[model samples]
Target: MLIRNKALFNKGLMLMGSFLCVFVSLFLPIWGGHGNGLDAADNMFNRLSKGSSYFIPGVKEDALKLEGKSVTITVKVKDAELAPRAVENLVKAGATAEFKDGAITYSGDLGKVLGAALIDADDLFNNRGPAVLERYAATEKNAEKTIVKAWWAVLDPSIKELQKQKLIQEAKVVGQVNKRGLEPGYNFYGINSEKVLDNVLPLVGLLAFYVLYTMWYGYAIFDMFAGIGLGMSKPKTKSEA
Candidate 1:
């Protein structure tokens, strides 16, 4: 009887040990890794989005919010000759252009007149090619400035159109006018800690349940074996004993 009890106790212990090993090896690590990975991803995206907004400045606002206001146009011209012509054209149409460093700026009320002026400038650049552009360069170094100038030249018309349609008011053109690009950042719409936790909590719960179930299964199996051993070790009967 004593021997049988000892055997039963050992079997129970073995079952429990097996359950713990399986539970820890399979479910616990997976649960941990999954939760951590999700957290890291959310954090990364949040940082990227915030950084973009900070660096780009004013990108968070609607594009059409600037409609009907006075604006300043800045450009970098490589060709000195084209610069004069560009400035002359702008001045003739009641828009002012000034050159400082290597850039030209046209500042005025962004009304229909300015818009029409931009359109005419666009046509001149598009149709005349390099020949018309060559006349504007003051030095050989300015030759390379054509592309950027042409780009600004083209954008003028679009800005004017936007003004006419009341899409954007009071515009400021900075950087290379022709080289328009998005500011750096991420623009995720609806991500928050609560949302992230909601998605992850279920996996964690499942893992806990699995661990508990494994432990219980081990105990149950041990109990069954112990009961069987106890029954077998009982004396047969009075006569036999």
Candidate 2:
């Protein structure tokens, strides 16, 4: 009955449009926004349980495989120097890890492996990963600067945390920026999400639409109800006489 009238129908349509925007946003290709990293963080355990090795990229002879509640993760470092630390990290992750023949292998509870992988991924985004990855990726003259720059670019969306790590002197980052042929341009994560559509927009948009729809139709509905009440209160017409 409420939607029978034109005004009420239009209000209902606007309310539905708002919900449509929210529904579409969920599957939209938003790279970074709050949806990518923070939402992932919130559902980390559930995501892990579903068995996606999101943090680790590529397939080594040893890849992190999840089966039931078990997990196996392998980390390969370009520098043998990083091997010890890699194993140590896995240990901290509650995995039985061993570093031998240039790679570290971790096997244990999926939760622990995933937790460690997430920590390492965050560490990478925070500059620790990029700084180290570029060293292996760079070989050409002045290529180190650009390669690292690209990695840093991917990590740039999370720059606030990178600044706090202090493990690599800020001076080095500055020096790399000044190096010749440095053109940072990789966005591995959802870096463009905020400009187009943000995760928070859905909830906020839904609320705004509901409020606006009420503003458009609230009085109209009340008026209809009031009219009905008044009709009942007054004498009824005798068969349309």
Candidate 3:
């Protein structure tokens, strides 16, 4: 290529080399030598995400509004073996649960039953797997038969049954409890929890690096293009006739 602007070409090369240096450093444990920059950022976000996913408290308020409301619903479990465990969960939650005709029929206060579910979800969310396991009298040997999954099996059918009975508000509240409360607990289980305030410095540093890195790339491209005489130029103004 012809040497259009040696100064701009050198500047571009310098910026690219510096960018590569930072890129390579990202793979090293530059963040306190405990983990690479990328890992640190990933862990920080995971923790922050878990911290923000605490919706059980709000769901509890809505669910408890269903206090003294009795609901009789039969929920089917796809896995026959797990039906009994789901029964145990509801029964433990102050509900009468019986497994018959290939389904578990529950009868009890709606609020109390949902309250028990929220407690289990809270335990799982806090990484207290033993608490949930103990609640269901289960072991993790099968992994699939965990208490959380059993909650899902029961909650799914319960929601449908509620909707069928035209208890729309009850159905919505139960669905919200399952989705916002239990789902987050299950999804974010085992992730570290952190407040944004506690991680302000690192969060700020990561965000700043992102902005600078993006701009660094843009500047590199702009300089390289300008050096090669490929830069955009302003169009000549048209003379008024």
Best-matching candidate per TM-score: 3
RMSD of each: 18.7, 17.3, 3.4
Which candidate's lDDT is highest? 3
Model 3 poorest ten-residue lDDT run: 139-148
Model 3, clash count?
0
lDDT of 1 by residue, 178-238 (tens): 2222211112222221333444565466568668876688575756567456443556676
Ranking by lDDT: 3, 1, 2
lDDT of 3 by residue, 106-165 (tens): 899999988988888888888887777776667657342366767877887788899999
| Residue range 110-214, candidate 2, lDDT tens digits | 434343343334333333545434434434553323333432232232123324544233323323322211121122221222221234565465569568756
TM-score of 3: 0.80
Clashes of 2: 2
Measured against the true structure, the TM-scores of the candidates, in listed sequence, are 0.26, 0.25, 0.80
Which pairs clash inside model 3? none
Q: Which structure is stronger by lDDT: 2 or 3?
A: 3
Off by over 4 Å in 1: 1-68, 118-151, 154-241
Better of 2 and 3 by TM-score: 3
